[model samples]
Target chain A: MSTATPVTAGADTAAVRQAIATTARPPRPGPLSTALTFGWRGMLKVKHVPEQLLDVTVTPVMFLLMFTYLFGGAIAGSTSAYLDYTLPGLLVMSVLFTTVYSGVSLNTDLTKGVVDRFRSLPIWRPAPLLGSLLGDSVRYVIAGTVIIVVGVALGYRPDAGVTGALGALALVVVFSFGLSWVFSVLGLLLRSPNAVMNAGFMGIFPLTFLSNVFVDPATLPGPLEAFVNVNPISILATACRSLMDGTPDGEAITTSLVVAAALAAIFLPITTRLYRSR
Target chain B: MTTHAPLAIEVTGLEKSFGDTHAVAGVDLAVPEGSIYGVLGPNGAGKTTVIRMLATLIPPDAGTARVLGHDIRTEGDAVRSLVSLTGQLASVDEELTGRENLILLGRLLGLSRSASRTRADELLEAFGISEAAARLVKHYSGGMRRRLDIAASIVVTPRLMFLDEPTTGLDPRSRGQVWEIARALQAGGTTILLCTQYLEEADQLADGIAVIDRGKVIAEGTPGQLKASVGTGGLKVRLLDPGQRGDAAGILERAVGAVVLDADPAALSVSSADASRAADGVSALARAGLGIAEFSLGQPSLDEVFLALTGHLAEERDATLEEQSS
Candidate 1:
């Protein structure tokens, strides 16, 4: 009804003048605060478009159910045992899959012109990128939680109990955070959101499957085994699996942290540079 | 072109090119502080490019600019701190509610959480968007989104604001509202660099105008000075009967200077440089028994001003731009 009325009906010229002339600008926000603000924006997007959240939520749930029920007997000879085996790997899988959306969302923001607003702001340059990833971390957490919850409901339990489960979730979230910077670069380089999505998955989807997310590397042929042995996802899954078992695989965990740190170190600056130039 | 007022934006030989296209080919401009300066051009005339550079969103290929005494090249952060740009496209987040968009900007600009909410509400009320503040911006009409975009820019009230084609695709009433908002901002001592393709938009809102063509400033002055430099206005007439328009054109040409026929068969116009002669042309039509529907003597439209300056219509790309009533 307000829209149907004349545009002027809503705008009182005197009030507009008063507001513009009277409002005092506050001091500029700090980098962390600005980034947190963008995180808030990401959360707002989730609130408005629940479908984006649903995309992350349902896809991982679907993956968990299909893998445990369909491939359980063939892969591990028991649904419950396979669930125990794959849930940690699937946790890594689900969370990594959600990282691609970081690029997709960044691409969306770029194409929509909102990035112009963010760029023009006097705040820290990497705030939006960092903040949105902070928001995507929520999606990662949700996906991980859902996978574990569904795994528990299906008669699978982590050998290391709640601490193991929580530790695994924390490790996956950190890795996802680092991996998201890679997609953020893609988002900046690509022209469209769809293009970014396709390219991101094109690289990530295969890398995900070729690793030991759904299958153990030992079952594969020698050449494939070597590839899977070096795959970072397999390394990350190994860390998650060990952490979930309360065994604490130091080599795998250290490798995953170093890989996460290395990815962030390599890609974060590139994403920032491309974001400025683009 | 010298004025006592301090300049808010000063540019010298600013240039930027995108691959083969020279989007901004060495444009220079001086915008006096506290006044609304319009960069008038057609679409793809590099108006957006110029604004983007001035806002420090993009670096210029080969020129220098100073906004509020800080150089855009060397002191970009300082320049950015003093200005805001509402892009040609609505820059507010579509997925966020209008209130959220403003609040987000406020918080980013460093307001406390409660202060951000308060300021957002105040802006929502002032811009007449309070009713729709809770609705996501994606659901907003073009007019509402434009309003919110402007509102977002002023949340921190920069010393200068770059409004790039602020009312491009809006209806006339929405356009008027935007004009009102621009004027209010100017009145509040915020110098506005308004970029627009609409000739009349510059004429109506700009205190001084730079007429850019093919990425160059072909003409620059106050609206009156720009119009005066192009000579005087024309005499536009609408004949009651389409049949009498031909006869009326003949009489008007004899009485006035040059006569150009309008697209309407019942309409024709005379390019008269003086008020007395334009009146005489109207009288001549009366004497010829040509019934007149309506007539007016006024300053030259910016189209004529543009044509005089550039030897081409302002809206040269798409002919439909000429049909828009100023």
Candidate 2:
């Protein structure tokens, strides 16, 4: 069978003219608009797979009840004192757990080629990363609020007023947000979601457990005590507890904020670099 | 459509290497504004690499490329603003519905809420997926997902669009649908750079064709120019009598002073430097009292052009399972 010539100079010229006439001018939104767009999309994704929020909602409440009742008497000789000691640790734990999901979601999006699509688009470089971090903060805040409310109901009264409690909560969220940058970087560098999840959990687990999260650092051996005393999460948790319980002023809050900010400074650029390289 | 300046897409000495493998060799291309230029090649010939560089996804090792008067290296943000890319596979989120995917892209492109919704609806209808707009993209068929992927790229109304093997896994019908969409995009005055392995696709859509092999461009021209570049045409002659094939071959060879290949007693294939020589051979055969049952002379097909230029068959490369296994 013979094939006809598909190209005609006149038709081609006309088509090209039409294409030029119809093409729209490109949009140039500022960084704030770009970040908001990314944040909005991340919120939409959270809305779709809401079962993902179960851990943040269910885990904190369960841990609050289990830890305070099961080990309170043995560890502190009384439930109320133990509840006072353990609430800060549980809050930190809840934030850590919720932040790990951010890594998992990032890994999933990368593997699924959604990140690649975003890379191909003409958006701000930090939009997706910043958006996901901000989006997961919703989960963190919800979990933190639920745990705090439940702690108050269970006789764990905050000696600090509403302002101090709010400050403590904000510190926890800011620290968790910083931690997310590290995990998002890990997710990008790792090959699989499970690998990222395992690595993230492994990294955060020791940092949380080795700290004075469950008990005072003084009760530990000298070497472990030194490590726990210096751990950033432990410092933050101590600071959080101090703010919530009106304990004596210490270097924990300032030290934790400085360390958290330093970690974010180091990791945020590394993650952005990795994302661009990919 | 004439302009004093060169074109929207202009490249020279473009090169990229992945570790030790030279993915894209020194290559040059030019596309008149709004023209659909197709890069036709088999896999691993640097089509994707070329597209990546053009799209500003990856920096080329060495080369100069400009799109819409913006240098890919220095003016990457400007180039990125003007263009959009849709890769071979679907890039839409499976967890999101078709409409959600479209709206997300639109929002990222800085469309207002009402404008994003309006554009999303327009694209869904254009791609014939309006009914499936509310359905999760994971439930979409392969064709539907591909269509949605393309629609997502168009949300920004890009001046230039790069489609890398956009129909590789699609069936014939779906391929046709995509072709129609591509043609419509061209009709809208959008410059398109299409990389495809299908020769018919290049022939159907390209204003100019570049044949790349082993990371270098082997040939470039309009389809007719490429065919003419072979500089010779072949004659397929079937003899009236099976035994006459030899006689016809001898007569044709002696008449044109060229070589003739005989496949069977009834068929003879003859090549000549030009159509006039082929006609001369046929006349000589008829004068020698041999009845010519069938005689036709024409320019070569893209397959023959590929073979003549590369000294190997296209089908041979496609049949080898080595690349696929790796």
Candidate 3:
């Protein structure tokens, strides 16, 4: 082969100069852009795997129908009253269940080496973790809306106006977001996806079930009642009920918001630290 | 190779430990700009650990490394911006298509939508993966996935690239294809830092080779220089008849002024300082009424050089593990 002509050499030099100039400038895809990129990719994954949405979509509808007809009359003394009582816990439960998937999703990414690939990139530090958290909120919102809409269809009335109902929904979404951060950290620390799922469920199930979600805490036994009164999930469920029923000034509502904020503050840093260490 | 030009990558006193075992201990190296520097070592010799530290993925326990004039500890983000690392395993997302994987990496590297798409198309074509562009990576062949993994690292046209055993588990043809890509990148002035256990790979590609044993570099030079540094070259003479082998070996040992290793009676091998002395030895042996046999002389191979410096063959490194465990 003949030696390179000046034309080819000139073109090569021009390309190199362009590449150098581009690299010398500040890196593109700033932190916010990188975060959104991760979030968008996660949402795309969810879009492709519609079967993964079965829990969020189908479970809430089934739970609403079963609880209203099967346990409503016996537990709440009447079916109508039971519908009003069970709706708040059902909404919160939907958010809780959705957050468990966040941990499993993160664990799957870690096991499959996807997270390691992200670590090799020149992107923002918290993008992958935060993006997954944000993307999973869509699942919570979808499930929450399905449960509430089914409740409305089955003759459960929300005394709160449209604004209060929306506010109540907003609280569930924010709480779910906060819970995802906690689970995301757990996913990073744990070895297997199943371990993350089981551990998350173990930590969350008691707080969710032992609370005054199914009935009034005042009516419970002594020690159990005291525990229920102090439980954060009880506060959140009570606050959600109050907001939907047009009674938003309860102590439970204030406590729930504070607890949600506190959990978020604690878990966000933990998740970021775990992500950086990995 | 470039007459001691400014180093593209420099590391001094690099050290890392995992719990009780020291992974990397007191290592130093300098890779010249636009040169292919190969760190040759067996598994668990801290090759991956060093690459991870240089890629800014893991913090070193103690040591300072500079890449493209930026410190790895304090200026990690800067080093990350200028360098790209492809790990030992394929790192592409299996769920995404080949085009999508490349585009995602390009976008993350700050390319605009059109630019990312264009770059992705170009890379797919360059790697001969254009036909598989729209197909999901989960369905790609092993070689295709490896190509895409390497292509993802070059999305930003990094000035420095770290390849940690890029051809591991690849077929011979695929390994040759990757070698071509590495050479092309170096020709474009992109500095490459490669780590591999394949002695032939280091011999063929490395401008400067560093042989790392345990946790430290025991030898560093150009391939030929390192081979020469092993001191003695040898000639192997194979006898046509197994019966005459013993007589031939005895005659050769008496004729040559060097050491003779006779493991197989059918083969006579002797180590001498130079080929001229070996020729004299062969003439003396032929005059001694011994049957003439086939003979060939050459410099020591990289494997021989490794054995001379480390006192253990590459294959023998694993055998020692069983002894230690027992």
Candidate 4:
């Protein structure tokens, strides 16, 4: 950070230009380096504009507190019983909702022409999109941490201890990463950030509400209740709940992993293709 | 005066269209190594589309181009390696500081951590943005952001650069600064394909200019050559007395050999092959006993050449394009 002798535009530029030309672009960087370079770029955004973390921090904690206090009595006949059932579901919801930011961020970057600048560079072409997806993992982790701490403070305990908690957290993060690819496509296709956000909410809100996030799937109406049972959100919620409660449901966990893997397989290529063509 | 310099860019019959709009209709150009080639046009004249094609940001749809000897379509990665593009606006990340943007670019260019850090510092100071290097690009002035934008591209000083309207939306002072940057880069043996709407910019910076209009290169030459192409500088004669106007006009026509056209009611103008011819015409009118109030030589402006080539003012042509797009 210290300043060396300031070289103005008119200074000894010949040597600088020569050095740059002869540098030979340093052996084509591997894909990991390219992705990390862009990942570092995305991480800087969260560092500089920490307020970007508001969704992961304030929103999740508020949802945890509101859900536990407001609906605990009606749903479980007591707040403590409700806390155990709802906390895992709420964790899934928080991470799911946080995926919207990925879409919004990509749309904003495109509109600003930053993505165009990245496109012109000689680095691995898909790095920007991949790095952005990886960077959003930070948000998922933050949301998970906030919800866990808040839930623990409100007298909820994870029966499966650190191993179970880590497993469940991994599932949530992986699920969100795959989900981000879907939003990345939305970001690439949408004309504006607001439109991306609105579309994202429209797609996400109903799934989260209709799934077994807040209530037991059995109590719902006929067809709507059937839809909730099969929803990915419900599958994820069941997986996380079982893992955190010391009884990892192999069937539920397999379904969540396969669904996440499927989301990524389906959307990653689609997003990358749309991004390059643009 | 002749030296074997490799062509920095050689492109032919390039074509691109957005739906029905032909953004770049068949075009050809050869930019000399270490020279600044200007692409002059009004807005939406396909200037950007051509630069994009050469810079490997997009495909040309038809035709072939090689940048620094690498093909644009098949060898696009190679094309991108040797060139950098700073688009019309400062296509830089505003979220990061100038320093961070530079470092990021350097890292992407495959520089090591310490090397990129050193290079970033060197470029920050070189572009005169050292003091504001830590400030976010959003906080930089229009001029500062542009300087950083160009600086970022040089993290691995590209052998060729595509600067699309680098001075647009800038104040006169900033425009001059950007021009200075272009000059400095050219001095460093960089080939520049500069696209601009300002005739003066092309005149000042371009070693060769391609004046494009309606998705084609209407004309191409150096500033002096393009001007001279319209015609040799004109000769205008004004008679002091209205009575002698007819006689003066007649005498000047025979003197200059070219037909004299009435520039207005009071003045007669004709093309002169050179300054000496205008000088001779003036004296001939004097010897013919014609009282001339004032006579002057006029050199054709680039606007006049543009008008002749396009059949309308550049502004009018750009307006038409805008109207069509809207």
DockQ (Cα-based) per candidate? 0.48, 0.20, 0.19, 0.30
RMSD of 2: 8.0
Judged by whole-model lDDT over C-alpha atoms, candidate 1 comes out at 0.86
Off by over 4 Å in 1: A1-8, B234-302, B315-326
Compared with the true structure, what per-residue lDDT tens digits does model 4 show for residues B1-326?
Answer: 24378899998999987777787889999889999999988788888888878877778789999899999899988888888889766888999998999998888888888988988888777677888988889999888888888888788878899998898888887788788778878877789999988777888899999999878899988888877676776777777776777777677777775545454667777654467877888899888887788877776444455656776656533444422221
* C-alpha lDDT of all candidate models, in order: 0.86, 0.78, 0.77, 0.82
Tens-place lDDT per residue, model 1, A116-139, is 888898989889988998788888
- Which candidate order results from sorting by DockQ in descending order? 1, 4, 2, 3
Relative to the real complex, the DockQ score for model 1 comes to 0.48
Model 3: residue B81 alpha-carbon error in angstroms = 0.9
| Candidate 4 chain B least-lDDT 10 residues | B317-326
Per-model tally of clashing residue pairs: 0, 3, 0, 1
Candidate 3 chain B lowest-lDDT run of ten: B317-326
Between which residue pairs do clashes occur in model 2?
A19-B188, A19-B189, A20-B189
Task: Name the weakest run of 10 consecutive residues (lDDT summed) in model 1 chain B.
Answer: B317-326
| Number of the predicted model whose DockQ against the real structure is largest | 1
Residue A26 local lDDT, model 2? 40
Q: State, as a TM-score between 0 and 1, how close model 1 is to the true structure.
A: 0.91
Name the better of 2 and 4 by TM-score: 4
Q: CAPRI verdict on model 4?
A: acceptable
* Model 1 lDDT tens row, B1-326: 56999999999999987765677899999999999999988876778788888888888899989999999989989988899989877999998999999999999999999998999999999988999999989999999999999999999888999998898899998899999999999988999999987767888999999989877999888988877787678788999999887788778877887777777899887654588888888888888788899998766665666667877766644332211100
Q: In every candidate, what fraction of the native interface contacts is reproduced?
A: 0.84, 0.38, 0.27, 0.49
